[model samples]
Target: MTPFWKLSAAGFAATAIAYGPARMGFGLFLPEFRSVFSISLQAAGFISSLGFFGFFVGLLISQFLTARRGPRPPIVLGLAAATTGMSLVAVASNLTVLSLGVLLAMLSAGFSWTPFSDAINRQVEERLRPVSLSLVSTGTGLGIVAAGAAALLMSIGGVSWRLCWALFAVGSAFALLCNWIALSGAGEASGVRRPLRWQALFRRATTPIFAIGLCYGVTSTVYISFAADRIAQAGGVPGLPANLSGSLVFICYGAFGLLGLVTGQIKTLTGLPWLLRLLLLASALSSVLIALAPASWAGVVVSAGLQGINVMMTSAVLAFWSDRLFPAFPSRGFTAVLLAVATGSVLGPVAAGSFASHFGVTAMFLATAALAASAALAIRSGYISETPHPE
Candidate 1:
């Protein structure tokens, strides 16, 4: 593989590894945390939501910092913060400390992920960018699988969840070290320019992009937040032995990345909007399947896989759209999309959790399916049409 490919792969791996513990692993460890901290379920959920909140704040900060200093410093700083945060969580004994740790970890993750993506977008050739991005996204799946395996192993070894987090922290530190080495000589000096106001970009193509992004974000957030729990519940998998469920979720995500590659090629062959519609339909169908699945492991796995494909396809398609819409400002456009993702992440979990708390997991799945369906309609109606540049 070429140096760019190697860097992309390394970057992807770092992202996946860092987020595995912070995002997916946290849910797996939630029960154990509750026991240790003596917190209520609602409180625990609130704490997890705090991480997302921090992520939002971090993204905003990253935009300004990256604009001024370019992306490297924030990326490095974010990775360092995430490493420390995860370590703090591993040793945290109180709810306040744990919450703070999670917050910091998420903030670091957001900072690292966005700037790294910006760097990749800046450095890589245009045509190869999507493939490289899809490859990078595969890291998320890999990390989730690793987290699940770790959870299972820890359970089998009679180790505490805290210990698992500590181990994950050690791994994250190693990942951070590797990223530092790989990216050390890769930093760019910021070009001198007047900083553009956020509103300048926001007011231009902002409404439609954010509108579409909101729908996409909500769907993604809901799916990620509750997919594992739903699978475990549906499959009757024990909470402690969560390997199969976690692995299944990650596998689904990986499959989705593969699907993204395939679909991206198809978009090149056919058209992007058409491909997006297909993804939306798939996502909607996946949700319904999850909602109606029998209490069997196979049913859960199948649903998870479908959800994975749906999400990956949606992301890939939207990314293509962003590239087309904002050819001059890929990072800014992508960040706009991410802002929507963050919004969805915030709303999805809270909404799903509410539905789960009041009704059941199935209802949450159904609601998410509706959201996916609505987004498909929005795309079809040309709410996200590309504007023609002045002749």
Candidate 2:
């Protein structure tokens, strides 16, 4: 196989394990976790927030590592963390162990994704870089599909949820091995080690990227952390078994999320700014749909499909956009964008929990929709330039 093909496969596997089973599984399995741990809804939200905070910590470590070392080390460490973390969750006998496992698993996501920006920048031909990045991100959809399938099977077979996590751990280990081999000779940068410049992160050129990241982060993570729980609480899809209904929505999410593979073409045709605006509109629609019809099988499934596309497409846009913005240090610039994402993710669930407590989950969803709509309008008003700024 060619180098691009190899990178695509490895990057796909890396993202699949990191984002799907490791980071996203917590939300997918939140209902089970809450029941088993005897935790309240508020407590569950807090744990989700803590996991996002851990993601932030991983991003910080990865930014410096990718700058000093190469993409491979952080990528490898991230997969390893996913493997170890999922293993712990598989056998957790108490809430503390489960929380620690979740933290480590989510942290892997921060480390796993951004390094690919640097890797593609250095390894792929410039003409193929955006397509390659989109291909890599589409792995998250596949991962979600696989996890949802496993969950559906578990429900049918009366298998334990722990077994599901064990399977996730095993898959993570496989991804780790694939990335380690595929990234051979892809390590250790030759450069002066220095602190990431605050100025670079705060530049006018990057303002829209940061703002988009923050808004999308809040909207996306809140939905991920609680959507299933809300659906499950609403008694799930009418025709399906209660346990299977929630899982089915994610399968739709992953299936539609595969649409992310076409993101490069879409961006080429529509331009990045327009693409971002459309995606934010989709997100707002998704949040509002779920809030309005959490129990409707068609409604929640459609919401997941919209969210799936938004999640995958936005990730690809951010990767290439940051690469465009900071060619000399793609990972470093991407790190700043991801940090903004992580910040919003950390804030999202906590604030959402408060909203859910004071009002209801419906209120939380409506509020997130409003935030997404406001951000989309801001972009429409030319708060962000229509094209990438000149380097």
Candidate 3:
């Protein structure tokens, strides 16, 4: 494989482990976490909320780390954190240790994503940026698959959540090694260290992009943190899936989400603006299906497929759009995108979790649908500007 292709491979490993298992995997196994800790719905939501906050912190640090040094170190650090953190979660006996493990794993997401994007961008020709990024986004789908497979394995072997997490940590170690080999020296910054310009980073022209980020952030998190839980709920106990088992729903979601790898092709046909709008609509439609008929296998299958498509499409759009708007500072543009995403990460679980705890999971999905609809309106209203094209 070419060097850029190698970078893509490393990125896939990093993202799969960091975002997929370290971050998204938490929701997949929230039932186990709650059972072990004897926590309430509110508590599980709060724990996920904390993970997002850690994600925010990691984003902030990534801004500096990628800016000064390069992608490899931050990627390495993030993967290491994931390796250690998930292991902690695996072995923890109390709430405090479990919380710490969760925090570290989420924080690893911050470190892995942006830096690697920088690395990938650096490795590829300009024409290939969107395609490359889309390839990396697919890693999340792969990672989710890994997590789901682990869940399936757990079911087959009667493995404990703790044991699964330990296995995840081992997987992270492999990811870290993949990154080290692929990005070492290849991704390190070369020129004089330049500070991120706040003015450019927060310019008025990019407002619409930020708005898209916000909409995506809120909607995606609600789904990521709760989608499986909803599936499980429909499948069993008060908050747990006592029926089809957690792995089945997650495998469906992960498998369908792989559609995002084609985001570059969609962008090529529709352009960034329309693509965002369309995907947001897709998200809304998926949310409604799930909210209206959580237990329906048809609804669940379609919902997972749609959610998977939009989730990857949204990320590819943001990266592609940023390339069009701020070619000089991809990292900062990504930071803005992630900041909105991470901000939503904070709000999504809290709102969804609390709503689910009080009213029902369906109510939370309805709220998410509303969020997606508003985002589509924002796009239609020119919140992003009238056909932004890079010079």
Candidate 4:
């Protein structure tokens, strides 16, 4: 394989290994943490939110660093941080220490993502960008599956959750090694340049892009934070088995990513707006089903699968639109959306957790469904337009 494809594959592997076990698995393990530590649900939510907040901080910092230094250094730093973070989590004794570990892990994950994505966008040909990115995004789903399997394995072995974390730490180290080997000699070929100003980058993206960012942030946050919990509640599954629920959620996510890969080609053959509309509608419908599904495991699985398809489709659409809108600065433009995503991620868990505490998990799912519906409408209303290009 060519170096570029190899890099993309390595990036996919790294992302799946890091985020699946570290970030998304946190939710799978949340009930355990809450039970073991005797913490309030809100406190548990805040702990997860803290990690997301760290991701936001990391992304903001990465924007400047990547613009100036290119992607390699940040990527390396991110991998190291992730390794350290997960290792710390393996031995954390208290809520505070666990939260600290989560924060660091998320920061590292965000750092890795921003620079790696920036590198991919800069290096890949325009025509192949969407499929490449969709492939990369699919890594999250793969990671989720792997984490679920790991959790199940731990359960069978009668091992503590801490040992699972140690496994993740070991896996992250391997991923880091792979990243180093793949990226070696790649950076020197591209000359280093001075970092661009954040203000200038923002000016170029305009309000529409920012709106898109905001929309994405809100929708994704809601989905990621609540999808599994909603499944547990809706399916009448107990909290102990929620990791299985998360595994189901990721299965849907991965399946939809594959769908996005197939549908992305339609955009090349037909038009962008049609595909966007289809994805938006799918998102809306999935939200509705998730909110309204009867309390059964089967319902939860179906709902999660639908929502996954919607999310993966939206991901492709966003990537395609960002490239068109900010052709000159794809990394900066994409980062703006990613920042919004991180912000939403931080807010989503807090809001859902609080609502679930006060009202119930059902109410939380309904609220998330409403937000998804609203986002779908916003995309359909023609408020957002693809930048016209010369054919």
Candidate 5:
């Protein structure tokens, strides 16, 4: 395979495991998990918050590891962490074990995501880099679709959650081996490594983008964590079985994955600035749809599809922005945005769940819609710029 395709293929599979199963699977499996563990909504939210805490810790340390040893070691270590973490979750006996498993799995996304930019920058030709990276990102959608499909089967066949986690782990292990070989073939950087710098973390241009990421962190995480439960509570697709909402999460993911394939083309058409703006608006609309879906079953399906596309667009655009801002130190830019994302992810569920415990999910989503609109305004008002400014 061509080098660009090699890395793209590897990155795609790894992301599916890292983001789809190891990390995002928590939200997808919340119903079965909470029932099996007798977890309260607040407890579930707290667990999700704890996972992001692990993600934050990993995000902090990955750059240090990457700075000293390039991107290869950390990527491999992350895949290992994911594989072990999912295995642990599959057989977990208590809430503590499950949380630990989730934490480890969540760590995988942090470890795997940043290095790819550096890798692609190294391996893929400049002209093909954007398209290649976009293609790799669709892996998250694929992972989501896979997870959703698994859940669909489980819902249909009455399979155990234990099986779900085990399958996710087994698949991750296979993907890990492929990712390791692919990354290894990309070869290590040859020059003396640049010393990790603190100043670049605070460049003026990154601030707005980081804030936008923060909004995504808060709203999107909450939606992922609680939206399904909300659908179930609201009586789930009106005509369909209530138990199938979990399965539908996969459908949403499938839609996301399929739509995500066009990210490169979409970026090429809209360009970054307009694309970011449109995504913010699209996000706001999606949130509104989620908030209102209880009244109309058709809205549930539409909301899920929109959410999938909006998220892929946002993540793709963010990755593009990070690479543009920090050509040599792309990881640092990614690190900054991730830290922002981590903070929002950490806080989002805790706050949204607490508010939901009082005002309910509908209210929570409307509040999120407000935040998404604020993000759009922030972008429109010049917090995020189209051009990269030198540090």
Candidate 6:
């Protein structure tokens, strides 16, 4: 196998474990966590917020490590965090331990993503870099699919949630092993590392990228944290148990997320502006579908599917976009974009939880849909460049 293929495969597995079972799984299992821990929606939101905050911390650390050392250290460190964090979640007997585990696990996502930009730039041919990044981003959905399937089967078999988390830890460990082997003897950073230039980092040309990131963070976090709970409360689809229905939503999410591998092709055909508009619209529609028909199995499944596609595609777009915008500092610039996203993530759950307490989850989802729609309108209003910024 070629180096690009090897790195892509290992990167895919690393992202799958870090984002899927380790990071996103908390929301997937939120209902059960609530039941066991006897926490309220508000508390759950707080925990979710804490996890995103941890992601913010991880991103900062990752940028530093990736800039100074290389992609290997941060990537390996992230998988190790996934393995350890999920293990703690698996065996936690108290809410405090669970929260700590979740924070550590979510941190892996921050660590896991940005370094790949550096790796791709270092390892792959320039023309193939975007494709590799998109493929790696698609791993997020596959991981979700795997975790959701496991949860569904376990739910049916009456297995313990703890056991499910333990299995997740095992998967994380395997991902760690894959990355360790794949990244062996990887090249470290070369030359004198320059500090980030905030002026270049915060250009008017990049406004839309940061805006989209923030909006995506809010909307996606809200959906991931609450959509399943809302579906369960709506009694799920008829003829199926609520838990199964929820799991199926994520399955649809992960399965259709595979479609994001085509994002580079789509961007080539449609250009970045149109792609951003379309993705934002899909995100809006995903939330609107749930807001309008949470109880409809078809509605929820389609909603999850659209969200999965939008998320994966948008991530790929952001990866290449930032890489192009800051060719000299691919990982650093990408970290800035991710930090914006993480900031929104940090605020989304807590705010949504509070809003849901007042208006209702459906209402909160509608509000989120509106936010996404407004972002799409912003794109249509010439807020973004039709093509990528020059290197």
lDDT of 5 by residue, 8-62 (tens): 9888888888888787788888877877898878888888888888788888877
Each prediction's RMSD over C-alphas, in Å, is 3.4, 2.1, 2.9, 3.6, 2.3, 1.9
lDDT of each: 0.67, 0.85, 0.78, 0.68, 0.79, 0.86
Model 4 ranges off by over 4 Å: 117-135, 188-206, 230-243, 266-274, 277-281, 284-295, 388-391
lDDT of 2 by residue, 228-300 (tens): 8888887887877755666876788889989877887999999877898899999999999888887797898
Compare the candidates by TM-score and give the number of the best one.
6
Clashes of 4: 0
Candidate 3 global lDDT: 0.78
* lDDT of each residue in 47-140, candidate 4, tens digit only: 7788888888888777777766777777777777777888887898887778888888777767776577666666777777655666666677
- When sorted by lDDT, best at the front, the candidate numbers are 6, 2, 5, 3, 4, 1
lDDT of 3 by residue, 1-391 (tens): 7866887788888889887889887788876666678977677778888998999999998878777787777888899899989999988999989989999999998998887667866778788766676677778888887788788777667767778898899989998888888886564676876565657666567788787787788788788777766666666423434533456556777888777667778777986668887899989998998788777667777887788788876776777677667776666767877898889888778877888889877887998998898778666544565334343
Best by lDDT: 6
By summed lDDT, the worst window of 10 consecutive residues in model 3 runs over 236-245
Selected candidate, larger TM-score, 3 vs 6: 6
1-391 in candidate 1: lDDT tens per residue? 5546765866786777655666655665654665578755346456666777777777878877888777767776776777788888888978878988888877765676666666666677788776676667667666766776777676677877778878877877777777777666556745766455345456544466677677766676566555655555555444434434544555555444455557667877757566666677777777777678634566656666676677666666666677666666666667777777777666666666766678777777788888878777766435546663111
Q: Quick one: how many clashes does candidate 3 have?
A: 0
Q: Which stretches of candidate 1 lie over 4 Å from their true place?
A: 1-6, 34-41, 117-134, 200-208, 233-247, 387-391
Question: Which TM-score value belongs to model 1?
Answer: 0.85
List TM-scores for all candidates, in order: 0.85, 0.93, 0.90, 0.85, 0.91, 0.94
